[model samples]
Target: MLWPDPAQRDRLVEIRDNLLARIAEAEREGWLGEVEGLQMSLAGAEEKLTQLDRRQSNRSVVDLGIPAPATRVVGAVRNKSVNSSAAHTPVSLP
Candidate 1:
């Protein structure tokens, strides 16, 4: 599975959340066109999320040395470090 880098993942999550909120507001304001646009964006955001998950399987472990260093992802790039929390947070969707 290919996982998105941390920054990309975070951006995707943010986009999804914003889209949801905007969609809700559009519906309330009776703006059908706006609602549709927001819905489409929401769908794209969701698709990208799925793609990210399909690409990355954190469950899969790779060994580089005797002691494996912790890894962090930055925009689909992987960086290894011992103490970094930024690499672990993935977008959790409902």
Candidate 2:
């Protein structure tokens, strides 16, 4: 497990428990729809947390000594005015 540290593991468990409690409370309050949404959100958060833990445990620095290519900007950019008339009109570029 990436979270070999006891403190980090405990924090993750605390967060999971808090989310579960919130779902339960929502259910008890008869907010079925809200509870469902909350459950989905909590599941996503848990999955991300697990992935992060794994990444932290297996992180390593490797220097390949390769230079990255320079980025180039292309194409003309135009800015449209918000809250303007919907009618099509020629916009002059400065």
lDDT, candidate 1, 32-54, per-residue tens: 99999989999988988888776
Q: Candidate 2, TM-score vs. the true structure?
A: 0.45
| lDDT, model 1 | 0.83
Error of 2 at 9 (Å): 9.4
How far is 31's C-alpha from truth in model 2 (Å)? Answer: 1.6
Off by over 4 Å in 1: 1-6, 58-94
Candidate 1 clash pair list: 1-55, 1-56, 2-55, 2-56, 3-55, 3-56, 5-76
Q: Per-residue error at 85 for model 1, in Å?
A: 76
Clash pairs for candidate 2: none
lDDT of 2 by residue, 1-94 (tens): 3333544666667777888999999989999998998898789668767776777778899898989998787986777688556556677899
> For residue 1, what is the lDDT in candidate 1?
43
RMSD of each: 25.8, 16.2
| Alpha-carbon lDDT, every model | 0.83, 0.77
| Residue 2 error, candidate 1, Å | 12
